[model samples]
Target: MRITDLNPHGGIGANSLFVELGPFKVLVDAGMSPKHEGNEAIPRLDLIDREPLDLILLTHCHLDHLGAMPVALRNHPNVPLVMTPASRVIAQRMLHNSHNVMVRQREENGVRDYPLYRRQEIEQMTGRIFPLAPDNPRFFSSLDGDTMTLTYHHAGHIPGAAGFTLEYHHRKIFFTGDVLFDDMQTLPGATFPREQVDTLVLETTRGASGRPPGYSRDKEVGQLVQAIRETLEGGGSVLLPTFALGRMQEVFSIIHRSMGQRQLPRVPVFASGLGVDLCDYFDQIARKTKAVDFRRQILKDLKVQRLPHGYKPGQRLPGPAIYVLSSGMMVEHTPSYIAAVNLLGDARNLVAFVGYCDPDTPGGLLQQAAEGEYFLFEVLDKRAMLAARRMRFDLSGHADRDELLAFALDLEPRAVVLTHGDPEARDWFADQLRTARPKMQILDPTPLEPVEV
Candidate 1:
């Protein structure tokens, strides 16, 4: 069996992997680095005909992991795709969003535009998808008279995310798509049967530099509540910029739980477009789970609030309120951006980030904003400004260093290949693993590079 790192091997985004087992070719993911043009990062894409691929296995629906499906499908039209139900739904939306992002990038940057694939191409790709529930194993296809079985296990990074186990050509390979080793504080924790692997493809997104020993989600809730209470008492609004899906719902649930316990101040919480959609999705999930069934009722009772996309400027937020908005990275065009501009005018207001922020994104800028950073604004047909403080609180969805190690150690594979991070992160992670397990082989390859096992 041979494996190729398509995009995420060297960088922080565009996590795609291809596997060649005899006559069959299987693609684990097809995302390209966001910085790449038209999903054309891998040079080999143009060289291969569509007939070689037998199957496509998706780990999740994140744009970085699944965005290139339409592009891959355009070249390999006959291949069948395997993904979880929720992943399929979310992937469709995210890919559509990616098309928009790409188009906007082309128009605004004045570059000649050539999309990887159009909306119709994504639709064609969807027809080839076959949904798989957690822990179920199915035959992918027969290539060279060898049958391949693919099994998906939960990875706990997002809803319907999975780590896959593939069996064919008398070899077993495991892909740790993305993982959070600890019992989930948001989504359900993952479990992988230890005896099922020869090659383990892992991720080192957080690298070996571990996080500081911190409190649980509930404890973090306490800290946020304290911060908000103090800030609200000072008569300022608190703006929380979060992701539209998993991260947003997790934060909303935290607030709801805190409110039920009377630990949070009575403040209005607001959501953006995609954030509201995610909330409804969570409401459905909550209804099915006995432990979280009360959440739906709580949300119904509170009906916290929502900010319309067309919300007018000069609108006042309810006093001492908290607003949860979308586009977690604090990039422009998100509701959080509007909220940030509206609320930042008050020196007393705080913009708190509760998730990961890409350094080039607006949230990252806000996080780095100092005490005197002048935020420009317009007031009554005149120029205005406000000085704001950026406070960051960690509510990360990815596994940290120790969690990554523990997960890999538990899997106990013959070989571990790391992906989904930069060179520093992958190097540190490999070093840590080697120091702990001297005999194990850990590999980190560059993008589009092939590895033989």
Candidate 2:
């Protein structure tokens, strides 16, 4: 088997991998980088532009893993796309939302090549997605009369995230696509096969930071509740810069349960942007698939007020409430950025981040800024004084470094390839794996570089 990394920056962004297994060629995850814009945001599809692809596998609907799918579908028009039922629903909406964002960027930022794919194109491409039931093995015959079987296991990262296992010529290869071993507020942890495989393709997103001492999901949630309660008691609102997909849902669930248990004050919770629409999709999928133990009317039952479209930044809410907005990193022009400007000047308000933040992003800058420091808001070309309390919780969706290392050692694969992490994260994993399994072969392939197994 031969695998080539299509992501320009190893596995950090635009996570596409070209895998050749005997007579079959497969592409996994065509994504766009959130940190880059225009053509730079997309994977280097040019490397495999001329190669004939047999199939495309999508693990989830997160932008970094499924954003640039239209580009791939446009090139390989006849190739069948495969994903779980929930991902199929989420990807269509996410692609549509992405197109809208790109259009706005073209006009606002004067980006000439923005909106790389049109709405009509996305609609056309989504028609080709084939939903595969979880745990059911599907067989495909290659041109060389080889029978290849594929099975998907729950990944526990998102509603439809999956870790896939490919079997060919009696050899099994497992790909852990953005996995989490611990349960989130809405979904359970991953349920991968315990049996050994010949090869393992693992993601090392959290390898750079080992698990912190005295840290647990419950503890983190309790801390977040305490912070929000303090802010609300002080007559100030709390802004949660949430990712529209999984993180938003998790936060909603957390707040709901906290209020129900009286751990948090019963303040109004407002949700804004595409995340609210995406929640509708989640509600539908949860009812149908039971992938998560969620109420079909959870959003309504929780009494989450949908922020109106015309709501301006810094506009005083009715009372001390929790504002959950999209663009978790607080990218310029996103609601989170706008809300931060309004709330940052208030000492009583609090801004809480529940997920990863790129150091270059507005959220990251805010996290590092002192209380009285001035932060430049690039979109508005203005600077704001920071006074609100800023806090980061250990609400990451990836497995902890030690847990990942233990998982790898248990698998005992002939070879392991680390992907979907920064250089430091990958290096940390490499060193740990070398010490733990002296005989195991660990490889970190560069972009477009193929490694044979």
TM-score of each: 0.89, 0.97
Per-residue lDDT tens digits for candidate 1, residues 125-172, read 767989887788887556346688888887777777788888876678
Error of 1 at 72 (Å): 1.2
Backbone clash numbers for all candidates listed = 1, 0
Task: Name the weakest run of 10 consecutive residues (lDDT summed) in model 2.
Answer: 292-301
Candidate 1's C-alpha runs over 4 A off are 36-44, 183-186, 282-299, 312-318, 375-387
Residue-level lDDT of model 2, residues 265-295, one tens digit each, is 8888888888888878888888788776556
Q: Which stretches of candidate 2 lie over 4 Å from their true place?
A: none
| All candidates: CA RMSD (Å) | 3.3, 1.4
Error of 2 at 331 (Å): 1.0
Positional deviation of 172 in candidate 1, in angstroms?
2.3
